[model samples]
Structures are given as C-alpha cells and as structure tokens.
Target: MTSEKKTYNFLIAGVPYKLKTSHDDATVEELVEFVNSRMNQALGVTKNGSYQNAAVLTAMNLAEELILLKRKAHRELEKLEEKALQLSMDLENSKSNKVLNN
Candidate 1:
C-alpha cells in the first residue's frame, strides 16, 4: 500500500530541519535526538571544529558503528550455521547407529 510522506520538523545541533518521511512523529524525534547527541559528541572532541566538520565526523562515527555491527552479525550468523550443520550430522549419526543395533 502506498502511504503519503509527512513532514517532520526537528532541530539538530541547534539548526532546524524538515524531513519528509513515512516514519511516525516519535521515531523522527528519536532520530533527531540521536543526531544531535552524535554531533555534540563530535564537537566535544574537536573543540574548535565547525558545525559542518562536526556533522561530517558524526556521520563517519555512525558509519563505523554500523559497519562493526554488521560484521558482528555476520560472524554470529556463521556460528549459528555451523552449529546447525553439526546438529544435523549428529542426528544422522544417531539414526544410523540405532538402525545398526536393531
């Protein structure tokens, strides 16, 4: 189903922004808060940095966090796949052993 995008007005790093998104009001507000927090942290680290620089740094930091999370998730999925394979092999061996003893 197609839904109309709604305008969400928010402030980040003291600057006002308007976004057209399908997200609910609360989700937009939460994202705005996250962006502001990231930018503030960037500014804190680079005391003399401009707003643009802080914003860029914040983006880089968030990207890094996303990449690390993706990597961790991939590793976990690999582990689960290996465990499943092992369980399948164990089940097959048990079935064969039961037939041999019968």
Candidate 2:
C-alpha cells in the first residue's frame, strides 16, 4: 500500500501558496526561511513596529515584488524562445543552401 502525499497551502500576507510533502510531520522550517528572506528583501527593518505587524507588512511587500519579478522573467523567456526559433530557422536555411550548392 502507498500513502498519498499531503499538500498544504499557506499565505504569508495575501498571496496563496501551495506545497506538497510526504506527511504531516514535514517540517515547515524551510518555508519559514523562504518567507523571511522575501520579507526582509521587501521591507528592511528600518522602522520600529510590532514583530507581527512587521511580518505581515513584509509579506505583502514581498508578494508584490515576486509578482513583478515573475512577469519580467516570463517576458524575458518569451524573447529568448523567439530568438532560439529564429536561430534554428537560420541554421536550417544555411544547411539547405549548402546542400543545393554541393
């Protein structure tokens, strides 16, 4: 018999996130680290505030930044794909021309 994997969704601020693990005993320490890193990048601890509020605000900021970065990466990927296609076509054309000349 095989046990089904468990998936959990967690939201730091407003973003919905999903992760799959083998069991309920899966440690969330990694997830916490990821969240903390993003939060720190988004909101540097430059102001005096409660830890909970700061965490929430940081998450919100990080979510927005992540979205923007994802969009930018997608656009860059599309451009690279287009360039690859063009290069492949050019290579094929060159090969065909060489064959005709031979």
Q: How close is candidate 2 to the true structure, as a TM-score?
A: 0.53
Query: How accurate locally, in lDDT, is each candidate?
Result: 0.90, 0.71
Clashes of 1: 0
Model 1 lDDT at residue 41: 91
Off by over 4 Å in 1: none
lDDT of 2 at 10: 73
lDDT for model 1 comes to: 0.90
Worst 10 residues of 2 by lDDT: 41-50
Q: Which stretches of candidate 2 lie over 4 Å from their true place?
A: 1-27, 36-52
Residue 96's lDDT within candidate 2 is 100
What is the C-alpha lDDT profile of model 2 across 1-102, one tens digit per residue? 126677777764345667776645435546656775766554456365455667777767878888999999999999999999999999999999999999
